[model samples]
Every structure is written in structure tokens, then in C-alpha cells.
Target: MSGRQGAAISRDGTFDAFDLCARRATLEGIVDATTLPRMADGVADEGGLARVAWRIEGTSDALGRPALEIGLDGIVPLECQRCLAPFEGPVAQRTLLLLARDERELARLDGEAEHEVVLASVPLDALELVEDELLLTLPFAPRCERPECVGAATAAGAAEERTSAFGALAGLKPAPKNE
Candidate 1:
């Protein structure tokens, strides 16, 4: 694939994960979800910007595996399952990604790897990485965060109907000893 610029450095250029890890590079920038199709599809409004910050740790983990620390922050417009209304949900995540040369290496490190293992590819696609992280952080059940929302109240009480079947059956049994 053709190379891109910005956090996603051109592959022909100096964008290899190995080099980045060696140099301990840090990239801090704002990426547009509007630019990432997969991310854009899930957003209620594709106009929001994603703030991504990543640092390649020169040092390896206990397993001697290269790792990158990434953080993301953005407001994702999504439909609230609670209220069935559109709301801005805060998105944030920070995780360490362990970089491996190939699937074999990744598999070897699976048990000992303290962080998520990823295949280290050339011309690292920073934008794709950012989008993937953001997509994973998306709220599984988007809902209005407000405590007083009617939807929240209804959902809270919805479980009240759940009762122990044995308890209900006991109530139905007459108090025979009362006679």
C-alpha cells in the first residue's frame, strides 16, 4: 500500500516499528474519525475529532517484547440505548501494545506477554492503530449518563420484576399450620 504522512509515517521513510521503538518516539496529534470509515460508521456524527497520543517505549517488557503505550480521548456521538436519544459519550482508553515480529513470536509470548501482542509491521499505520483503539473503546451499550434520565430510571427498575421462583411458590402455599 502507498505510504501516508503525519503520525502514519511513510513506509519508505522512517516509520518502521522497530526503528520507532529503538528511538523511543512519541506522537501526539488529533485524528479525524471522518477520515476513518470504520470509525465513522459507528459514530452518530462523523464530525468528531480523535485525540491520540502514543509513545514507543525503548525498553521491552519482562518478556523482552517491544511495546507501545497509547492513549485516546474523544467524544463519540452515539444513540443512547437508555433514552433512544443521541448523546455524546466520552471515549478514553490507555493500553500497552506488545509488538512481535510474526504470529509465531506472538504465540510464544501469549502467556508471558503482559500487554496486548500485535504484529509489528513496516510503515506503521498510526491512523489505523488509533482508529482500532477508539473502535474497541466504543461503549457497548450507549446510554445517557445522567442519573435523572427517565430511561435510566426505567432500566434501573426493570430488574425489580425478577424474583426467586421458590419464594413466589412459597407464597402460593397456604400456611397449613395456622389451622
Candidate 2:
């Protein structure tokens, strides 16, 4: 949880809904994904901030017949697949996340399935969701900016070895014929 930080959710599970009701919302808190419900290192040199945003349509769940939507945007450092260098990039996505309280309510949410949104029994840890998405977005191999990278060095070495092998074969030729 090094350099970990994020907003606090009240015990009653309420935050200012209005604050995040704009076309875009900027949350200032380091949501230490290490502190999320379930998390692990899928690859090496993985870590950083996972900022989130909520684009509410109607209102918070506390409001009767309330309907809301959320969107997430942030960046995390990921190791490059090609060169194994670290790079910071965006992790942005928009989806429907339900805040319903029971399975019955969750099923009802499915009625709005065309929305492709999420239905949850509890208040979602917004930061955690963003963190997980960002982690999953990481590339399989990390590459560096330098054209002549560590991988290139290895390639050069392999080419030299092949050339030496060919030189040995050239020496085993038949003798020249005379008139």
C-alpha cells in the first residue's frame, strides 16, 4: 500500500451525490487498490492511483425511484510488454453499476439490461472498481522508447552466433579443380 490514498465512505454508506452529478467528475483521493476487497499482483512492477468519476442521471439510491450512472477514468503505471519499461497511460470506461440492496432489486435492475450496467447489493467502492479495470487494461509486454533496446542487444548477439556457424560450414568445401 505504498503511496496509497482515497476518499472515505461513511459507515451509513453515503457521499454527496450532487458533487458527482456533472458531465465529468474529478475525485481527489489515492484509492489504494491494495486495500480493495480483492486484489493481487498479476504482473511485475504494477502500482499507482485509480481515479474515478460518476455521471449521475437521476439521484442517489436513497432517493425513492432513484436511478444513477457512473463513469471511471484514471491512469496507472504498467510495465511495457516489448521493452519492459514503465509507462503511464489512461484507463477510461463507462458502464452502469447498480446500487440496489437485494437480489430482487438486482433482478429488477436487469429489466434495464439494455443499459449494460451493473447492479450491486451495496454501495460500490468506486475507487476499487476503477483500480481493477486499470489493472486489467495493462498490456502483456512492456516496451521502452529507445529504438535500440535491451531486446535489440539480445537479437544482435543471436545474429553474430548464426554468422559464426555459417563461417564454419564454408570452410568444409571441396578442393578447387585444375586443368
**What TM-score goes with each of the models?**
0.69, 0.44
Name the candidate that leads on lDDT: 1
Off by over 4 Å in 1: 1-8, 11-14, 46-59, 62-64, 150-179
* Tens-place lDDT digits, model 1, residues 1-179: 22222443564433567766666656556765656778665666643554444333334566565777777776667777766667776767887888878788888767775667677865566767777778788877776777667656776676554555557888998778854
Compute the lDDT of residue 24 as modeled in candidate 2. 27
Query: In order, what lDDT does every prediction score?
Result: 0.65, 0.49
TM-score of model number 2? 0.44
| lDDT for position 6 in model 1 | 45
Minimum summed lDDT over a 10-residue window in model 2 is located at 1-10
Give a tens-digit lDDT track for model 2, residues 69-123: 5454555455666566666645566544444556787677778765433444445
